[model samples]
Target: MIDVAEHLAAVLEAARPLPAESHDVAAARGRVLRHPVRAAVDVPAFDSSAMDGFALRFADVTAVPATFRVVADLPAGTDLDPTLDTAEAARIMTGAPVPTDATAVVPFEDTERGLAGGLDPVTVVAAPRAPGAHIRRRGSDVSAGDLVVDAGVRLTAAWIGAIAASGVGTVSVSRTARVAVVSTGSELVSPGAPMRRGQIPESNSVLLAGLAEESGAEIVLRTSVPDEGDGPRRAIAAAEEAGADVVVFSGGVSAGAYEVVKNTLGDLMRFDRVRMQPGKPQGFGVTPRGTLLFGLPGNPVSAAVSFELFVRPALRALEGDAEVGRTSTRVALAGGWRARPEKTQYVPVSLDRTDPAAWVARPTERGPRGLGAADGLAVLPPRESDVAPDELVTVALW
Candidate 1:
């Protein structure tokens, strides 16, 4: 009969971060970083060109129509150090290193060619140029030994690019935790299988598998077992043998005759039927094989809610992510609501913030919420008689 917060805290206290592993940057996307991503070397490494132009001394362009002799042509990646001393310019392309004596860069489009392309101080159209123009200063983007990206950041495409640019060919990232999903029920039939009377389609396994995959977990196994002792036991053993860090089961946690999941788990797990509607029959603990185990209710909405409130946070904690749980917000109830108040209720709700200062939320049935028809879940307090309009209520943001 504990509040949701107390239950959540207990679950969190029992969880710990997963072990780290080395992985390629390409494969590390969406995975949490175990270590700091400091710069191995300065960005740009050395002074290079910011534009394609001729490198010349600023003093040479003091008067109008003044041009310098083209000494040599420098393209990208050229290491030759040609000095520009007396009214001389070096033909430089983009990303080329500037000469030592050069103070400014005159774009080739602003001047005419020297006589016969020989050593001649030709005329320039523009006046005096500024020193260091079109020059990319060394380490302007990043200084040497700078902490480019910090630890605990979720590796992304931008992070990968930064790491590669910082000379990190390989990276050490947290290994994706492996998860095993098992859906149990005697009346469930797999997709593409023939359906029989009094049977429903098997979807919890797919849903659980998709959720695990989206949460940066590698699926070691995805299976379905009948509402029987032997089948569920076999599935549990298979999951443990796959080296899964977490094993999830949908259905058979409630008080039902076919609740083989609860009976088979025996003393290996702890059931927590919180005083919350829509997801009351939720359970989690360690499996017989020492891996984390969670038994979610069979109802689609119930299972989804259980995953959000319990399993999602645990996964995030193991991955070292700070934003581990569903964010909650306060919204004004658009209409009045009355329900049996002894138990906390989770009502599917749609939110609208057309007026930035206030948000309006309206509750609806389960199916509407599944289609993203609701932006959040309205949390009704336990033992409240009625909730009136304009009253602020807590909502779990999607």
Candidate 2:
């Protein structure tokens, strides 16, 4: 038997970050970058107009009802940088670069006799609203050579948008983990399949596959094998051939005489009692092909908790992410239950998020139905037995 932390440390040590590769920024969302993304050009590129108005010197519009000659038309994407003299204005559209020496932009509504053409004369009805009122300065948002996105960042929509705005087309990121899940049991049958008196529906592979995909992994294989002959060995061989970096096997790891997974992989894996209720048995090792192996208990609740605690961190670490563990927030207990002696307890719970500031948690209504109701897991420390209501505890929100 071992404490949970010791087992987790071993798993993390084996699950080093995968090699980094270059990917186009458009396809890199949710991937962790291995190199910093520096801006290729300045944001805004040059001083541009922020409004569709006339671009003129502020000194020319200081007086009321000022008249000016519209010298040139400057629409967005124009190559002309027409210089404006005193009292001379240009008809400019939004996003057009401001003419050199121009300091303000007044909307068409702010002027009387608005220009029907670039050469038409117009009268300004209002004074310019201070210099540089509606001009976006060059390099104002970001400068060339600036680090827009740092290394080890998980690219999100905003990050990708920033990358695109920086004119960077590609980024270096860690390759995503490829996972395979296998469920082992002689009495288990596929869901919706005809079952005998002793046979039960298999569901661990589906559960693990969903969990792995939720963590940003690509599921390469999902299979089930009975605890006899060479099924376990053959499944592992198939996973290796499929290029899986991690293989998670469910069941057949306890001390039972017919523990197929442990019996077959005992020379390669190290099985132990992990001192956690409902999930005491744990087995982990590296395969000959270098794929990390994790053997979890078959119970649905135990498998879910084990995956969240140990396997999820390994998956994140494989992506070079610094944050590899679940974040638990403190919440008030709405109900209490007895904790196991000398072993930490992870009770499935439902959270009352009625108030954003004050969250309340209570144990889900017991049984499979209650387990289905759970959206969180309340963590109670070891030796803390017989908890009372209204007490404070930390919960990991799903």
Give stretches of model 2 more than 4 Å off: 107-129, 366-372, 383-385
lDDT against the true structure, per candidate, is 0.78, 0.89
RMSD of 1: 4.1
State every prediction's TM-score relative to the real structure.
0.82, 0.91
Candidate 1 ranges with C-alpha deviation above 4 Å: 62-65, 106-130, 326-365, 372-398
lDDT by residue for model 1 (60-155), tens: 788868757778888898998897778788888888888888877776566676323444455667753477877787788887688877877788
C-alpha positional error of residue 382 in candidate 2 after TM-score superposition, expressed in Å:
2.1
Error of 2 at 269 (Å): 1.1
Clashes of 2: 0
Candidate 2 local distance difference test against the native: 0.89
lDDT of 2 by residue, 315-389 (tens): 999999878877789988886678677888888889988999998898887655677798888988786567778
Q: What is the lDDT of residue 205 in candidate 2?
A: 96
